[model samples]
Target: MKRLLAMGCGLLVLGWANGMAAAPSPDTASVDKAIVHLAPTKGNKVQGTVRFETVKGGVKVTADLTGLTPGKHGFHVHEKGDCSAPDGSSAGGHFNPTGQAHGGPDATARHEGDLGNLVADASGAAHYERVDQQLTLQGPNSILGRSVVVHAKADDFKTQPSGASGDRVALGKIEPEK
Candidate 1:
């Protein structure tokens, strides 16, 4: 059985050397989807799920959240995956791999994790959707394992490092979809 397995492996490598298309390596294989389940931090009751799906030229981000104020709130992918802190400070700063000034998602230059805002309706529910070209599901720059944070206030979009968003009311880690 061992010899047969060796021969099969050898044959597969030989076929690839002969110009047969090889299967994509796991490291480079495309990830079709990712997800995050947000839980309220501290005393907040906000909870929701955010889905990321690959689309042409970018990833489509969709989020549905409840238990929020009836207005815009700051939202972003934070640097650290840890959400242990009661105030959500364990997640650290924004996921600014490219080292950019804080800006709206549509800005010419912004943090890779800067996802702008999520507006809650009068009923304390918010639904958001957008195509983010800067986000990646694979590669070193991928947002996987990082954390998403929902702040208590709107992102002013002109702050220095992080928008003047208030407390982190909710947090979740980005993970590959099952």
Candidate 2:
């Protein structure tokens, strides 16, 4: 048995040397979990990670963030995954594939990316966990290539287009976890 396993491994290595590679892993569309590594846009010090796991009705979002003021900060997945430009403007607007107006996560008429707020404590650390029924990980409305933006202020949840969330402080593109 061990000899056979060794031969298989050797064959794989030999294949690699001959310009052949193993089959590709499942792409983002078929993945059940994803992670985003947040980085400050420019001069900000905010940093964090956000994770998404598919659940029964929707997806579970888990976020751990730091370097925020001791208050509420807007948090939402943006339409585009581009975080290249300073101030995070390259990410585009809030993800509203359904054409709904800005609202809270629990609102029925909210945009698909309206995830509400992240409250940081006095130490500037915030840990948020929520199961979002509107956010998805598969099919036409998949958020696989989107970006999550943390704003400088709280989401009013009643504004048009995007909640009155202030300037984007940190951003990270969602990608399938390796």
Candidate 3:
């Protein structure tokens, strides 16, 4: 009888251990769509809103920005969600969880945050829309909690690390869309 009781207790402990080791599945519904409302950095008037929605191929990025210099500007998703710094440095480097070298969105080897550039019109307003294949709202490569940064100059895709993008002009934290 003692042996039987010990066996039963062992089974119960094993089951409890298994339950404790399991992790809950990610909430896919909460990440179906996300948005970032951008605010201008110090001495800059750049402002924008970037929307990310799960589409057929990947996440569709739609950005509408104003007060830009009428040319190309670097746009990327940084690793951190904080945009508290006056120069937008609060949001750290590009979101490159895979440790890949910097390259354009089309490059076979590129950082997850290498989003290329946003072109501004003569009126200092820019509207950009593209479907990014590398970005995701869920899973390990998720961009859900990251931040979007708009640079003052263009992203010269060939440059190393960060494409030599100039000072951050605008920043916003990516969040789930209500």
Candidate 4:
């Protein structure tokens, strides 16, 4: 009887260990869509909405912004979700989980947040659409809790750690679609 009880206990322990090991890791199953509603920073009038949807190749990002200059502006997914500061400094630097250099979205070596630039039209409005392969809504590199920031100047793309983008003009936090 004693030997049988010991064997049963060992089997239970092995089963529990196996179950733990087989548990699934973090994924995007619950995050099919996300959105960020941008607001103007200090002394800026930029406002917009950015939507992220899971597509076949990657996340499809769509943005519509107004009140910007008729030119290109730097855009990125910042590391922090705080946009409380008037200057949008509350949102930290770009979200670079892989510690890559600052480059355009198509570059082979670039930060996951290096989304390049947004071009405003003559009416001070901009519409952007792209399929990003590096960004993810789920997993360890997820951008769900991060923030989006628009800069006053265009991203130079050649800068070392970050493109010499100017001051942040707009800020928003990424959240699951309601």
| TM-score between candidate 1 and the true structure | 0.83
lDDT of 3: 0.89
Question: Which digits, one per residue and each the tens of the lDDT, describe model 1 over residues 78-173?
Answer: 888888999999998999877889999999799988999999999999999999999887775777778899999999999878889899999999
Q: Model 1: runs farther than 4 Å from truth? A: 1-28
lDDT of 2 by residue, 11-116 (tens): 9989776432111222445688989999998989899999999998789999999999889999999888889999899999998877888899999988889999
Error of 2 at 64 (Å): 0.3
The TM-score that candidate 2 achieves is 0.83
Colliding pairs, model 4: none
Instruction: Residues 1-178, candidate 4: write the lDDT tens digits.
Output: 9999999999999998864432223344588799999999989999999999999999999999999999999999998888999999999899888888899999988988999999999999999999998888877678887899999999999887779989999999998897
Over all chains combined, what TM-score does candidate 4 have? 0.84
Clash statistics: count for each candidate: 0, 0, 0, 0
lDDT of each: 0.88, 0.88, 0.89, 0.89
Looking at candidate 2, the ten consecutive residues that score lowest on lDDT are 18-27
How far is 115's C-alpha from truth in model 1 (Å)? Answer: 0.6
